[model samples]
Target chain A: MRLLLVEDTQDLAVVLLKHLRQSGHTVDHAPTLKLAGGLWSSEKDAYDLIILDIELPDGLGTSLLKEVRASDVAVGVLVLTARSQIEDKVYLLDVGADDYLTKPFSLDELDARLRAVKRRHISKPVVTQSVGPLSYDPTNRTVWIGSDQLQLRSQELKLFESLIDSNGWSASKEYLFDRLYGLDQDASANAIEVHVSRLRGKLVDHGLEIEAVRGYGYRLRYRLDE
Target chain B: MNDLWSIRRRLFASWFLMLILVSVVVYWSANVVVERSLREGQDRNLQAVAQVILDSAVKIDTVIEFELPYQAFEVLAYSAPERIYYAVSVDTQHLSGYRDLPRPEASVNAFGALYRGEPTRFYVGSKPIFPGSTERLRVVVGQTETSYQTESTTIAVWIAVAVLVAFTLLALWAEFSLRHALKPVIEIENDLGSRAAGDFTPIIRQVPSEVARLVQTLNRTFDKHRGLLEENRAFIAQATHQIKTPIAAILTRAELLEKEVEERSRDSVKDLIVRARYASKLATQVLLRATITYREIVGVREQFDLTTLVSSVLRTMDPSAEIKEVGLTLLSPEDTPVVLDGDRIAIREAITCLIDNAIEYTPALSDIEIEVYETDNEACVSVMDRGPGFTIDIAQLSGFDTSKKDPSHVGLGLAIIERVAKSHGGRLTISSREGGGSQCVLSFAVS
Candidate 1:
């Protein structure tokens, strides 16, 4: 994929460029607004995705986001900036940016977001998979424990959903609270643990077990009948 | 706005003009009165002589001769110079000094009208030094035209002096009166200059009635404005802070969802929930400090180890620090108290804004330094960025006043930090360092 990176910092740009190129993206970089504006205004078909840094020499990335969205060009945008405050994030997202990353973010996260954005534009397989006796239903909010139906509470359902969503990856407790309960709700770390433990017990009661990844989060698994 | 011409000047200017007109009228009137009195006395003396001498002459003419009181004649002539014209056409030419009198039209009487080409006065029927019954004799008593000239000159000088004195006195009075009257306005101007933008201390002074009422009204208005601004600022801050709770929940849930999907499947749905969360935090940090009350801004000194706080921020941003290859360095003294009276949260946010700004702009290979140094009475925290130095037009980054789109003067993170510093009784100093970078300093009085 061809990507346009509108970042002011050369060092960060280089790091991003290297990481993105390794992840199979051809990247073009512009440090100033004039350069970025010239590149976009001149040709609309040169790039598939545009990554913006909010603080540019000539203009904010938002203007470019607005301009690009206004035109007939169907390019995707991923905004990268150091403004980590929640409000700034919301503003950028509201400005029609496809994705936003606060500064001091890892290339891995950026790669994840880029992949997510690319999958949106391209034709890809249906995002769910079933391995052996365990099956996951991301849309219906249901999970099968060895072909046996298991009942889970809304929170428990969300808890299992979070684990199933991660596939086999670990998620931080803070990350889970937000996914299960909204950010405004006062949910303690113990609450997340309680919910996760209960959901795991239900799966086990239906002949299944979930693996707890330490320092990260949880994963679901079940034994295949021989 | 244009109607606000200085009241003091307008009042005094009109007063001075009125004084000039009044003085001119009064002095002219006084001069006329003196002239009238002098003219009356002259008229009386001339009339007395005319009564005695003319009656005697009338009887003497009838007797073919009479005693001529030449002394009385001279007295009458001196008293009524240029006041009377006497013509005696007696065949005897009996008037003493008649030989030397030299027959000529004499201009007599102080009150004269121009007749023919000579200035003269005529008091007919009432005789002067002559009598007319059956005898045809006309006697004229007169003085030269130069006598009245002297009187007119003297009167003019007196009137000029009086008018000048009146003008000077009027000018002085106007000045003094205006000075006393405008004292309140001057005090108000001085108070406005010394007091800060948000400070609304009213001036209470005994002013003249009109000015007193005006100043009182203005003070009331200013007080009301101060309250309104304070309320608005606090409301915005509170709102900004309050909205974050829900936004926080949205971001958290999104992050949890993002974690669930695998590399192959994570590409579905919206990708901006975390960014939305960050925006909420930024808004709270920016707006909260702007709304704090001014009364809460005094004498806030507390001690905290700032180095530890920076280290915590480093940890918070650690995930990016490793990936970006950007260095975060803290240059502070070990085991030192960064004593300061201020909102710690605000200060932290200010620092976060600056450092975050630096980290955003600086290249991956460049370095960022968070410097801490304390003076005897002050503590300074500077965030220096080795990025492209601060531009000259950074002030123009926000507040597009001429814009039709209503940018609403939204400032950058740096601007928010500047506001926070000012609200805390401190200052945020920004300068471009030598070479290519920007430096920002938050100065606080030692606590």
Candidate 2:
């Protein structure tokens, strides 16, 4: 995936750039709207996704988003904002953003959101996987096995969904550290261990194959071919 | 000022007391002088009356040649009051002309201190009369001095009334005039009291010379601060937008880099470049906040020369100055050294930021002229450059922080300079060269 990134903090940008590149994607970073406009205009379909900051040194992301929409461009956009309220999220999403990620977000969570957005429109089919009758719904949260509805908390469901939604790459504890808990939360790499143990127990009783990353987080492994 | 109230109260009290004292003294001296003159005049008239009666007896004794009539002298004494007495010391027993004289011991001695063994002061103009040459009669006529003392007491009462009237009028006038003159000060105090609560209203008053200039400056200062507050509010909005831009860029780029890593594309080299751009923006924001906070504090002042201060700032930034090849020079030749009374550290920071701005904005190897001079009782420090100049009239607006909106000109530096200038009773002038570049000048009252 290709994206347009507009950030101004050096330390934060360096760390974010490292983690996001490690996650796997292409990013064209424009420090200002002026540069971003030039890049956007220079190459049609140069970006598969537009990751814009609402406040640019030169201008706002709303205009950029409007421009993207007016140009009939089909690129998915993920807005980054410091604001963490539901209204800002809704506002950005309404203003042509495919998704919204607030600041201090985990790299893995950001990666997951990107992948989810990428899965929306593609040359290939949307892959929906399951763990036994503990079926997973990426768009919804209910999972059932053996005619019995599974009861799981929101974070537990998120942990399972993250592992299954890794698109087959092994999910690691370090990756889950950034996802399961808020990056600004008082959580560590061990936080995944606590959540994964709970999730694996529920799925194993239902005859699912959820594997550990061995000193890392967990991964859900189940196929119908068996 | 702490003692000023007490001082005024003392003046008020003393003025009332002294007026009363002065009036009393004037009335006292006048009463004493006038009464003495009146008593002398009354004594002279009484002596003339006794001489006339004796003259009538002496002429009759010389003409008729009969025994000079003692009856006539007696009748003269009878006509006068009983307090009057006439005594004749003769060859016979004392021929008297007294109805009843006050006893010699009781009477004030007519001859005073000289009368003990001496003749009685020639009667103070003696009227020694003859009774057909057989005896001599001294017609000493005087009312007892009790009635005279009573007259003097009445004169003193009049002086007391006059003095009372004078002081009462004076007190009324002094208090009335003082209150009227100070009414403006009271109004100023009321206005200042409200302004103390951050009202920022212009004072409406005309006070005495001592307080007039002070009140005017206070109102002007309020207006100045109010204007700056308004500007700061605008600057805050502008700053929020500026800060948000970089934060948003970092966020959006972070998400973008994730996408690049997920695909494992050979062209993922582009992701690192994207992140570096946002990293520099972070630096910009940190500097921006530092400058804003440095400017925001209510600045203080002390005496310091700009030459030494600017040199130190430049020395710390020498490497950067060298990198830009912008020569920084401090050219000042005045014993009238620039005296600044402002927040030394904050002002130094402001100056350094400005110098840094000049160094960064100017073209490489271009001359950056920094000079300090004394002008119009003010110390002026100017940093001129051959780089791109400001677009608008920054000096005229008196409040426009800066016209340049370059990534480097976050406008924070310009705002700080303006704020510091105002604190030191001065202004910042930013004028463009006719051809190119800008001249940024910071003015301060030469303390």
Candidate 3:
């Protein structure tokens, strides 16, 4: 995950930067809110999360947070506040902060918060989702059973992706074929059935079922035993 | 002086004493004037009778002839029953009744005479027979003072009654007016009494000018007190942030170094990290406790849900529990929330301390249950941990004493919990739970 840490304290920031880098994350450090804002806007698309310190040398980190949220960027913001006053925390949470940590927080705790924020971001797409042991990642076009990616042909992957987008509703064969192949490519209606059969075999042990709606297409549902 | 401490009593006593003094002075002067008037009236009556006797005297053929004026004596008898006498004399010869009656001295025209052991008022009058007849007749009349004494006593009694009436009215007026005058002081006392404990808000109500001074003094003290508290709170917050930041960096840096160091040096670095973390924790708890104490002095409270607070705290602690492989769970009633009135920050800190202690002591992968529910008209939060149960009696734990069954775990957490619970009209109970564990319960009344 890529992160921006906005902190004025140099030593604390260095330690946090070292820990984040050692934990296999790309982190950028900003010693002041002005620099933080500049870096955030110039590289807005590059960051997946922001660890914001409320007490900044130039401006309140919350203002920067507000600017980020106003720009409608889908990045997670985790606030760090020195004072644990509940009202301020509640206000920060209300204003689109994903999470907050009080001062003197452990590096492990910071990592955990980063993971939770990322998970929340992932859950927001609604189309790509994970339930029990089944996960569908839309960005990478992969379906994961537990930690292992399910092996599927390109056409089967497209068909399964269309079913997940249907969100528990049946996907018609015409819709599945349109999604599976581009306009230049031609596919027969029976081809959707072949991909569905093969995907069902692969999903046998996973906690999911590809249910056929008679005369229409297939929908994905969790297996009841799970 | 002691008697004057009560405003009501002092006002009444002074008013009563003043009324009595004025009444006595007025009564005494009035009695003296009445006595003088009565005596002058009796003397005038006696002089009239002597003139009548002198008018009746006449000299004929070398001897003076006279008739006693009985009508004058009859008029004197009307005031009260009393004896009367008269005498006529020319050249020291007594020629009329009651010759033993005393004569007036050469320089005195009227005098008192005692006759038959009864006191009498007398007057002497002399008249020439004709303008130049060379013969002078003197007459003296005397009367007992029974009627004069009776009239004086009656008048004195009337004066006494008037003074008594005046005193009574003054006393009643003093009692009612004094109470009305001291009403503002009572109001101040009542205002102070009804305030919440430790509340330092100024006295804003209007008061009498005299009592206004007291109110102003109190308000000044409250302002100073609030100022001091605000400064103290700001310092604590700033100090804690400053202290915690460096300590956090040290611990994190040491941890980072621990990973890169060789195996033999890694252990020592790990120990350094632990000590740094412990130092940071102590600083946080001590400062947080100070913050709580200042807030308690300010005495602000609001109503909130203990269930919601407990659940939120548990969620915050979830990551920490995961690091230790400990499962922290909250059990609460679904329908009724554990709603209570208190300072939310203090309560949260107390609960945090309890759960933090449990997490530190309990072995990894052990379960710690935080149960919040209402029972026996009380809202309770009980943290049960699968740590080694208390070796010493739980009731014997003291906040000041560092000595404990587990030397590493001083009783600071327990002490803070107990203090908060007691301040909130709640109770803290530490007991060894069934089947090998310890439970600490903080409870407050529902209503």
Candidate 4:
């Protein structure tokens, strides 16, 4: 992944840039908002994510964020700030920040947030989404749990994709049926139930669950107890 | 003073006293005038009757003889029902009717004296029997004053009573008007009474000129307090940012060094990262405390669902828990919302602190169970961890205890949770689980 880091703290910036590069990411560091704006205009499409610092030498980073959001390029923005006020967090999100990290954050947490941000704003064609031990590759339509790849039939894969699209919210049975079998397909109504049960059994050990909603459909959730 | 009278009462009291005094004075003057007028009319009739008798007296040769004038005496009878007495005397000799009647003294035309055991008024008249004669026949006409005296007393008493009644009505009207004038003041009292404790908005309602200055002064005081509070808040925000940014830099640097340092020196570098992280957390907790205090002063309260709030906090803390290989689970009542009325930010901070502490203490691969439940009178959130239970009495724990066994535990997180609980009319209880773990319950009153 390519990232643009806009931070003024030299020591922190040097360490973050090194740590991000070591994590197999390409990064460009800018210490001021003016320099960040120049880089953004020159290589706007080069970055998959932009790591922005709120307080900069030239001006607030929010101005640059607004500029980036206004432009045609759809790049993910992650804000880094020392201010942990709830209002500031809410305002940053409202200003089109894809994610935010408070100062003194651990490198591990930073890596996690970066991955989460990338998964959320998947403007690129190929991206992998990982939840708990489960990872899904949208490009190849493949699912992996740890070292093992999940085996699912074509119809079951379609059902899993439909449930994942709900984002932990319940998807109606009618919606799942539509995704599993199109209008011309001749499949029994209970065929969706059979596929869901099979998918649920396979994912039980993968820290994921497909819960059946009464009078509705199904939702995918993390099986935290296990 | 406890005994101090209100302004309305004071004004009404003074007005009452003044009105009573004026009523008395008016009554006395009116009585005097009415009695005098009645007496003058009675005296004129007596004098008229006496003059007729005196004119009727004519000289018979050289002797002064006067015939009693019956028609003239009848005029006195028409005035009021009273016994009449008349006397005709030459010098000190009484010659005609009612010889015992009191004589009018010299140079006195009308006099009051006791005659025939009754209070009577007398009129004296004298004239010579012939022109230039030194001998004058003196005529005295006396009438009992019981009738006219009773009439004048009745009239005077009625006049005094009328004046009293009129003035009493005027006093009552004055009281009513006074209350009407003080309506705005009463309204102000009610406004202050019903106001929320943290409401510093000005009393901008229209008031009489007399009370406008008082309201203005109150509004000025509120403005001053509001400005001071806002400055304090701004200072806290700026100070928190200033304090945390450098700590964040140090922690990040130490974390990098931990990875690059030799195996033997990695522990020390890790320690440096921990201390820096602790410092950053302490700064955040302190800022949170100030914010909670400020919100309490500003009375920021709203109703929110406890379950939903805990779920959001869990989501934010999930990554951190995941890093430690600790599993976070939420067990709450389905379909029913555990609602609470309080400062949402403060309560959220408290729940976050509890979960953060759980994540810190629980071992890797262990589970942290957070439950949101409501009893009959309380809404509760309990965080149960499968970690080593408390070794010391939790009640004795304070925020900056240096004597703790663990150097990383500053105890500020628990302090913050306890403060939040108390502020919401709730309590925080930390008890050991039946097994080797701890359960911390933060409960607030349902209201």
Mark the 10 consecutive residues where model 4 chain B has the least summed lDDT: B392-401
Candidate 2 error regions (>4 Å): A7-15, A23-26, A31-33, A40-226, B1-7, B33-37, B40-48, B51-58, B61-150, B161-212, B220-447
Model 4 achieves a DockQ score of: 0.25
Better of 3 and 4 by DockQ: 4
Q: Pick by TM-score: which candidate is best?
A: 3
Ordered from best to worst DockQ, the candidate numbers read 4, 3, 2, 1
Candidate 1 structure quality by residue, lDDT tens digits, B329-399: 67775566566665555566667767776776776545577877778877788888777765434344332
Query: Tens digits of per-residue lDDT for model 2 on B334-435?
Result: 354666665566567557667877886887556677888878688778989887876554444433344554422345456556655766677788888766
The candidates score, on chain A by TM-score, as follows 0.54, 0.55, 0.59, 0.59
Q: What's the lDDT for residue B423 in model 2?
A: 60
Give the CAPRI class of candidate 3: incorrect
Write the number of the candidate with greater DockQ, choosing between 1 and 4: 4
- Sort every candidate by lDDT, greatest first: 4, 3, 1, 2
* Runs with alpha carbons beyond 4 Å of true place in candidate 4: A18-26, A72-74, A106-112, A122-135, A138-226, B1-3, B62-87, B96-108, B111-122, B130-132, B140-181, B202-221, B254-282, B285-313, B324-447
Candidate 1 local lDDT, residue A215: 80
Mind giving the per-residue lDDT tens digits that candidate 3 earns over A65-154?
A: 999999967899999877655456668987889888877677777876776566555432335577447777776555666555564545
lDDT of each: 0.61, 0.59, 0.77, 0.80
Give the C-alpha miss distance for residue A189 in model 3, angstroms. Answer: 57
Per-residue C-alpha lDDT of model 3 across residues B1-447, encoded as one tens digit per residue: 585677677766787787778777766777788867877887888888888878777778777788877788888887558788777887577777777778666667777767688877888888787678666787878788866767776787688778878788878887788779778888888888976566687888989888889899998998898889879777877887777777767877887888789998998887787777666666666666666667777776889999998987786676677556566777675445888988887888789888988998887656798899878778899999989865544465445446554333545667777767766878888788888789989987766
Q: List clashing residue pairs in candidate 3.
A: none
Global local distance difference test of model 4? 0.80
